[model samples]
Target: MKRFFSLPNEIFSLGLSPGALALYSYLLYCEDRKTYQCYPSYASIGKSVCMSVNTVRKYVAELEGRGLIITEPTSVITRDGRKHNGTLRYTILPIRNAVDRYNQRRLRQLEETVERMRIRKKLEGNEEHPA
Candidate 1:
């Protein structure tokens, strides 16, 4: 097993909960390809993260909600007509995309702050300086 890289700062900047981050990290570690996609059982992930299987499921949903991972759940039917749950396929979103989104959101917030400042200055009878 190869440990490719540590969690990026952008992941924390996304405001994910601790459980979500741990599950995401475990998924990254288990990823088998350059694409950063993996198939791991909840029980395996739970054991690795020292969390309960239910907690792992909850946090996986959290990661998915934060757009950090995409999960596709599959199902199979046996010949005797029994339905079995299939492994979950997780695709980790690219860090570049996450960073780009964070930068864009920061830009919007700054823009809003500047606009508010301009309004405050105008109400205070301050002359606008030409840039």
Candidate 2:
């Protein structure tokens, strides 16, 4: 897996908890296809980061509610093709009132992902293909 990236200290200005900021960073680390995009799973994330699933879930919920991130539970193909990895279709909602400007392009990527995943499942013949 690639190294995790920070959401920048400016993210804290969005009124997010430190845990939430970390979780949000992990989410980005997991989903980012550019620059250290590789990321661990929830279970791996929990263990690697030394947080219980319940605690991770709690902060995840907080991040969700705060509009710092968007999530939809779903299964995604693992980069290694070892097994299908379950992931949240997460899109960081840039705080318009804070640092950087809104990233409309990344938002479009999330939209496109939803559409692509819908198409992927259809083409998969519903077979588990080990991933």
Candidate 3:
């Protein structure tokens, strides 16, 4: 039996670095279809993606920063009745949300650029006319 998952085309346009894209794809592979969540240790993700644990951590942060996923710290109770930190729980957000955000950001940036160009043109015209 082969396992598979779909990667959204919008992801490529999200401007994620290669590492971040790989990590995000791995997380989607591990996530439960219904729950859209997965709990995998940094070591597990790193091994699957051929990245160092620290590198995995960095990509996880990048994904979170881009609103592609959300991570929650988990805890486990040992036989000694002591609580210890466990694997991080990752919840995959809808790709549409991320895409919308990315588009919005790009739109804002373009608008700002256009406004700057308009101002520069006005200033140049004023200089030429000496008014």
Candidate 4:
């Protein structure tokens, strides 16, 4: 049996690096169909994505920063009653939400640029008029 997942076209427009994109795709592939969540060790993800554990960690942070995924720390109790950290629980957020956020941020940046240009033009006009 072959497993597959779909990647949204808008993800490419979000300006994520290749490593981040690969990690996000791997998470999507691992998530449950009903829950959109998965628990995978950093080593597991790294092995699957051909990245080092530290690189996987970096990309995971990148995805979380971009609102592409939410990661929760997990703990497990050993048979001896000792507690230890376990694999992280990753919840894949909706691509639409990410796309909306990206669009809004870009719009704000463009607005700020336009305002700066307007101010510069006004300053130039004042300079030319000797006012």
Candidate 5:
């Protein structure tokens, strides 16, 4: 079955690098509804995003740092009792929190701007009215 993931516009507002955005998109594409996560190898992710494995790792780290995703190192054991490292499990975070943060920052900036304007208007009025 073909799977699709919904990406919100807040991604653009997040200011992620191009590579990070591509990696994020691929991760979203790979998300399994049942698990709410994806575990693609770095090489596979690189191939999908047209980036090198190292580049994929770099961007994935960036995403993790930005709180857009969470990753956990995992391992698996084979039938022969051999232990091997498995793909990194990634949990994509809902963008609502990020969106709220962005909105709060924007609102603060706007408030500051309005305050500055009000102060300037008061100063100008004082200068003109000799008060």
Candidate 6:
């Protein structure tokens, strides 16, 4: 909501879209709440987090595009229940580094998408941009 993203701006001295932050928060929670520090494959992570693989892939792409996380694809277990040979790599940026980069990049993308609104204004204007 407007209240949540607004808090990041006030606390971090940078901007973060709700979606970008949701991805970051998930990574952080995986670390802080569940102690998952190793990189997570998109599919496994999706299952673990209870989000659809498509949603995970979408958010992971957003995180990578924002430089909040670095991602790579490997052959992971296929959908047919065969354990494949590879998996995707998702490296979360360090929190300190990600804070600024995620915000800055998200702000830039938001500026582009906002259509005649300042990034902050646009964010304040919408509460439901998802992860």
Tell me the whole-model lDDT of each prediction, alpha carbons only.
0.84, 0.66, 0.96, 0.94, 0.88, 0.60
TM-score, every prediction: 0.69, 0.51, 0.94, 0.94, 0.74, 0.45
Predicted structure with the largest lDDT when compared to the true one: 3
Give lDDT tens digits, candidate 4, residues 1-131. Answer: 88788888999999999999999989988999899999989999999999999999999999998899999999999999999998999999999998899899999999999999999999999999994
Ranking by lDDT: 3, 4, 5, 1, 2, 6
In candidate 1, stretches whose alpha carbon ends up further than 4 angstroms from where it belongs are 1-16, 79-81, 126-131
Task: List where candidate 2 sits over 4 angstroms from the true fold.
Answer: 1-6, 33-40, 76-85, 97-131
Better of 1 and 6 by TM-score: 1
lDDT of 2 at 57: 82
Question: How much RMSD separates candidate 2 from the native structure?
Answer: 18.5
TM-score of 1: 0.69
Q: Comparing candidate 4 with candidate 5, which one achieves the higher TM-score?
A: 4
Summarize candidate 5's per-residue lDDT along 1-131 as a digit string, tens digits.
Answer: 97567887889997789999999999999988777699999999988889999999899899887778899999999999999999999998878776676678779999999999999999999999993
**Poorly placed runs, candidate 6 (over 4 Å):** 1-22, 29-37, 74-85, 102-131
Candidate 1 vs candidate 4: the TM-score winner is: 4
Find the 10 residues in a row with the least total lDDT in model 4: 1-10
Give the Cα-based TM-score of candidate 6 against the true structure: 0.45
Candidate 4 similarity to native, TM-score: 0.94
The residue pairs that clash in candidate 1, if any, are none
Per-residue lDDT of model 1, residues 1-131, tens digit only:
95576777778778678888888888888886687789889999999999999999899888776667888988889999999999899999887776677678889999999999999988677455544
- List RMSD in Å for every model shown: 4.9, 18.5, 1.1, 1.1, 4.0, 13.7
